[model samples]
Target chain A: MDRPVSEAQTKADLGETVLFKGAALKLDCGAALEDIEIAFRTYGQLNAEKTNAILICHALTMDQHAASENPLSGKPGWWIDLIGAGKIIDTDRYFVICSNVIGGCAGSTGPQSLKPDGSGPYGTDFPVLTIADMVRAQGLLIDHFGIDSLFCVLGGSMGGMQALEWAATHPERVFSAVPIAASTRHSSQNIAFHEVGRQAIIADPHFQGGRYYDGDERPRKGLGVARMAAHITYLSETTLQQKFGRNLQDREAVSYGFDADFQIESYLRHQGMTFVERFDANSYLYITRAMDYFDLAADHGGNLAAAFEGTKTRFCVMSFTSDWLFPTSESVQTVRALNAAGANVSFVEIESDKGHDAFLLDEPEMHATLDGFLKSAAQARGLNATKEAKDD
Target chain B: MIDPKASAHGNLASSRIDLQLIANRVEPGTKVLDIGCGNGALLDLLVSDRQVDARGLELSQKGVNACVTRGLSVVQGNADTDLSYYPDNGFDTVILSQTLQATQKPLEVLSEMARIGERLIVSIPNFGHWRVRLDLLLKGRMPITGSLAASWYETANIHLCTLRDFTDLVDQIGLQVESCITLSNGRAREISGKPSARHNLLAQQGVFVLSRG
Candidate 1:
């Protein structure tokens, strides 16, 4: 029998945190995470058939708290703009789920979590993780919740990587997939970026070979520098010019010294400094390495289209105009691959000055596109009021 | 003959059509096709007020859906290639608003529209306009104003044409300009003695009703 629901439980029940303990996650590399702890919150009530669930994968440095308040930051979820009431994801219409990745430093178990030996943090000992490994962990979580399949898998950036992985690995499990501002494989340029970030962290004097946690100091300077460098790539030169345009910080005239005279410099510094407080340096290293190693095409004989062969899942790939890191060309390539595989795919390049972060920002065009796509997909799946039973 | 009081339906400000101008040209029950129709404002007005059997082709899926949701028959098609699919003489009057400049093959699409319809109404941004020419001569680069919202690299308009280029294309294509209207913003201006080069730019935009010579 179900226990009595308390007021807090009732509110939680409105968007409850469903835990799946001891979940077995067998990775592609043959390593397994025994007793995996998945922390996820579900918005909107699951329909009787449990068919309306949409899983929103978060980017690197992001957690499961998609629309609700983040327990770690006590701030509204990063994607609250797109996932809350009357938003594009529309919590009132669809059951939404967002989970922290297995290797995430969030509330979910990660390298920082205690090891079985009681030897403190896992650190470097955390088994080498892959995008597929994360997907496998999510699969176990979905299984425990008795969700046989998801209505859709949606995300941007690293989250978009997970969305693609979900479609490629479990094509039947996902009816539709919307991957925005992402690439199918880790490009050489992306690997170079990650390597730079990794080198920056390792070069720090305070890093002390990833064992800095025991010491009083953390790799704040190194991590901050890495974040600052990486943040520059997330935006386009056009966006930078439009946003900051060599404008002086605070004072009217340029300081001319190395004191972040430019507004863009000051903004990047702020982003870097803010990131270090919430994210662990080691976790950053592991996640960046995971991203660098990610290559979906390499595993499928260098043919990206072959990766999604015979898949029935529909896809909507979106890219932003000012997102230089993952430009519209990458999204077009993804669409071409999906099209080559005879998969149903739609593509849109939203015009925005918000760079790669446009997916997270207030983009009316993106919202409209996503809303239309999701509603149509729901209708196609026979989930909503306009349900017409037909094979998609 | 131009109707000065013609207004579009739904988000009227988003459109640049003079309902009276369209009504004066198009009779009730005439077959009409609007290319790059934004929000189907013109088509909706034409259908309801003039009883025009209107169809539209819009590049934006949202615009097409908005048109459809309003019970207006519209197709999700680009002016670039999708115009070739329609049968010849399918429409009595083909309307192109301020969307001609944004097309990839403006001349080819205009010719196609003329072929599909007995008459074609083409409205385009006049690059030869004084402000644009001054912006080019003085600024030495493409102008980014309220009209032109994109950079050179991002603009969909590969073939930017002046009023002279459009008129020359009409001559070369063996099409007759039945009537012409010049406008600065939304107000019409007389172009009888106005220099096509200097005055076209000052006028900002122009519309030409054409038919096969």
Candidate 2:
């Protein structure tokens, strides 16, 4: 049997881990991890000037396989549509890098990574992380490539938070930043939802206080339940109604019991079960905690504008109309701060019914806006435009 | 004098009399905010020609998206309500090109423009123009002229004003007119002194450059 050509090409693009021996990553929580490692995948060639590099930060559940086949799932990458040859991100024109963030399970320095002393996986012992910490880890990886400044740093949700952090903390090194479906800080409601997920994970007997590494039975049920609860937040009520709508699953009538009777329930169960197979329970806890700890304004004396004061990085912030998790109002706050700081910023609230997940879905308005913004940024950065521009 | 380079722009031309008049008044390399910048035609001109850091606020989603497609910084917001988000003296010039009359709160919007911008450039269709006056008088009903083409009930220009009424509002808001030009048939000429009844009656539109008193 012959394999697909794209799969063969993507596997070639997939990169392994680059260990930074003796390099210390100082955390926001007063802890430092030395000899950290970053697993990243790259697409396209870096121009001679090294001026056409774009760093794509991944969301909470996304890994480094942004525009390739995931080695684990044997599935297409999350952003395969937006970041390929002649795509909106256009790998043919620029170098695109996506890395598994620190505290993530994907071959990076995380809860699953063994301790330096070789005792076991870090597990629950991983120091509490922040969005800034993840960005700091990424900065080391960029340094290894000898790239002084990224042409653009962009992402959605947690990835968006990192993009903003890169712009705020390392302003000189970022030429542009795009934060989609993100907020300056995680709201209380978001924290509450995360708490519910964490509680569900902790309640599981197999979790063994986050040290399920040695056991054959990892906390699959707990992680699955956590994913199920969190998945509901990613979509809007409208999308749930439209997609499933109290419809029965493989039957004409309700089961009248705790079985997956509704199509929505079955769908959620499948989502949770599949997610558990790929993601670690402890990594989820650390990553969500990091997101909750993110507050760009709090660190700047409660002045969000102070984060980008006198910065030159251009910004484009986007929000979905139906994304109540990170609502349009949050994007408005960010835009207002960018305005107050006298930064060059563009904002677009796209009409999306898919909720926060809209950024990951097929949104023509979002794609068009991003394409135009990137093209303009490329021109400003002096990156040569491709001969054949994708007609978006 | 009309800029020979102005013809290079795709949609922007000397034919957009109000926009050209507004664009000409803006200094190069200044921060500009264009309220109701439909499709960002004027902003595109200001950014390329003047090298100004231009931003826009448009009410229509279609208009905002179009502006973004051009890589111009524009936000979808209403002039009547969204002005408070901007900081004081945020822009060197804030333009309201032919959009003043369409605003729900013309006075508040003007005041907010003055608050946020060091200078405010406003243009409005002159309701006191001879064509509008003649149509209303002769027809004994609401006037419909070239500039005010929409029917009275259908028009978004709820706060229609003449050059004199606009000047009065500017004065009432404690804004001094730095320069004033009356436009008629794609032509613009500076008023020699304070806008009089003659200017109001003859001009189809008026563009005023104002500063806080």
Candidate 3:
């Protein structure tokens, strides 16, 4: 796929402007944000009816640039393979939209953004938020675009959580939803992992109670440790063995020292170090809390089925074989709940060794499955290939 | 004329159809459920040509979505565990094409498939074929080829069996074999033959049409 000439050039080529900005949503913690900003990018052209729109939510560390070059890291979006021309998503066929979520550090209103009280940053003082808050903010953005209903809301990981929220809350507004590698409720194990990461960040003296933006001496070490710990959960034991398998890093034998002697150790160190460069520590604290607080069943009168009661939106739930973070068992539970609710739902557990990250990687089985499903959905909507508008 | 508009983007090579065979068994406008409906070729054919009220239950989300995009009614659910949710005798025929072996509990699923539909169509690689037996005796290891493409450690066919084994299970479970068709790589073959150990590999595969006894 060819790169869009330039950001400004592509924006000019778009011929029309689609701004995504709105007012702040008041939090339950008795705090309010004003004049909130949302950064998003759109692909393909919306038809006259505007029913061809697809909303893609990003994962924990990902931003709104779904298929564009990231300004912060200068790297292409994490999901370029699945979101390009003629790809499984087929940006040429659907009007794809990806946005940075609320309570995110990446250009969205978050702890790092300016506070309503004219303070530099909200930091630890930022009001606590939830996944529903993020979804509510996304709803505002969708409304800003003048789109009534989304053709499909698709996402994985934390993005998948948002997709589920969109379907459960605004069932009438979404035609279909594809929630990949996610769970309806946060598992106790997941909550434990998030607590460990939070502790790692707070343990650093430089963290200064989450108000560490004053100096260059940020909580890099603590945040890096948090990233390393969380990264371990993102992979399966089988995948770890296949990729590292206790192999010594840069040496044949163990040195019996604190150095990264094992390949897995070195790999995790690299992942953690790289993550701190582009992420804010306070934002990590906020997002992890949001994820831990996610429990859809608890919110809807303790009935998981009632969360999606009486909605006609189609659902496709997918999970990876080796993803223990949100395993196939969790997905099956969700499917069972949906079945009990009598909602039209489909589920697939793709065999993969990539663990939780399978959704981001190039898995042929995943691609083939998604391509077939999306293409079928388009056809059902009466948008045949011959009738589909061309991208000049 | 096969309208290009009917064919959604991408060449559906994996979903080649034997329309004559399918049409002979299934009537026009009959309710059908295709298990493991690869790319939904059969359901698509039935819906477009015969105007059949076809619903599909596919394990692959991509496959289910493809069927949906083609405007065919389908749900994404595994035949192994999800089949029990369907009401008894929900469809006129439940088609399981080349996907029975990949299931964890082939016998249990087969029974479920039969219970949910009036009739069931099953296709499996003929392990009893002489070639498979020869390969087992000669090579001394599990075979890996196009149709069965997995090593011993990763093969999804945990419950592989021969044509005879399938018949024995059907008989044991009180299900009758309505119409059985043996095939050798898409070509028809005789089911009864001398126990040529090489027949396993040579026979390649077989398709059977079965119903409740």
DockQ winner: 2
Quality of model 2 by C-alpha lDDT: 0.86
Give residue B186's lDDT in candidate 2 (0 to 100).
74
Each prediction's RMSD over C-alphas, in Å, is: 11.9, 6.1, 9.4
Tens-digit lDDT string for candidate 2 (A311-368): 8898999999999999999998998888778788888999989999999999999999
| Candidate 3 lDDT over residue span B22-42, tens digit each | 545677877787776756787
Candidate 2, number of clashes: 0
- Interface root-mean-square deviation, each candidate: 8.5, 1.2, 4.4
Model 2 lDDT, residue B1, Cα: 9
Model 3 Cα displacement at A61 (Å)? 0.6
Q: Rank the candidates by TM-score, best first.
A: 2, 3, 1
Q: Give the least accurate 10-residue stretch of model 1 chain B, judged by summed lDDT.
A: B1-10
Error of 1 at A133 (Å): 0.9
Of the two candidates 2 and 3, the one with more favorable lDDT, higher being better, is 2
TM-score of chain B of each: 0.86, 0.92, 0.83
Candidate 3 segments exceeding 4 Å error: A1-32, A384-392, B1-42, B49-54, B58-213
RMSD of 3: 9.4
- Model 3 chain B: weakest 10-residue lDDT segment is B1-10
Q: Please, what are the lDDT tens digits per residue for candidate 3 over residues A91-113?
A: 76778888787777777778887
TM-score of chain A of each: 0.90, 0.95, 0.92
- Candidate with better DockQ, 2 vs 3: 2
Query: What is the DockQ score, from 0 to 1, of model 3?
Result: 0.16
Q: Ten residues in a row with the worst lDDT in model 2 chain A?
A: A1-10
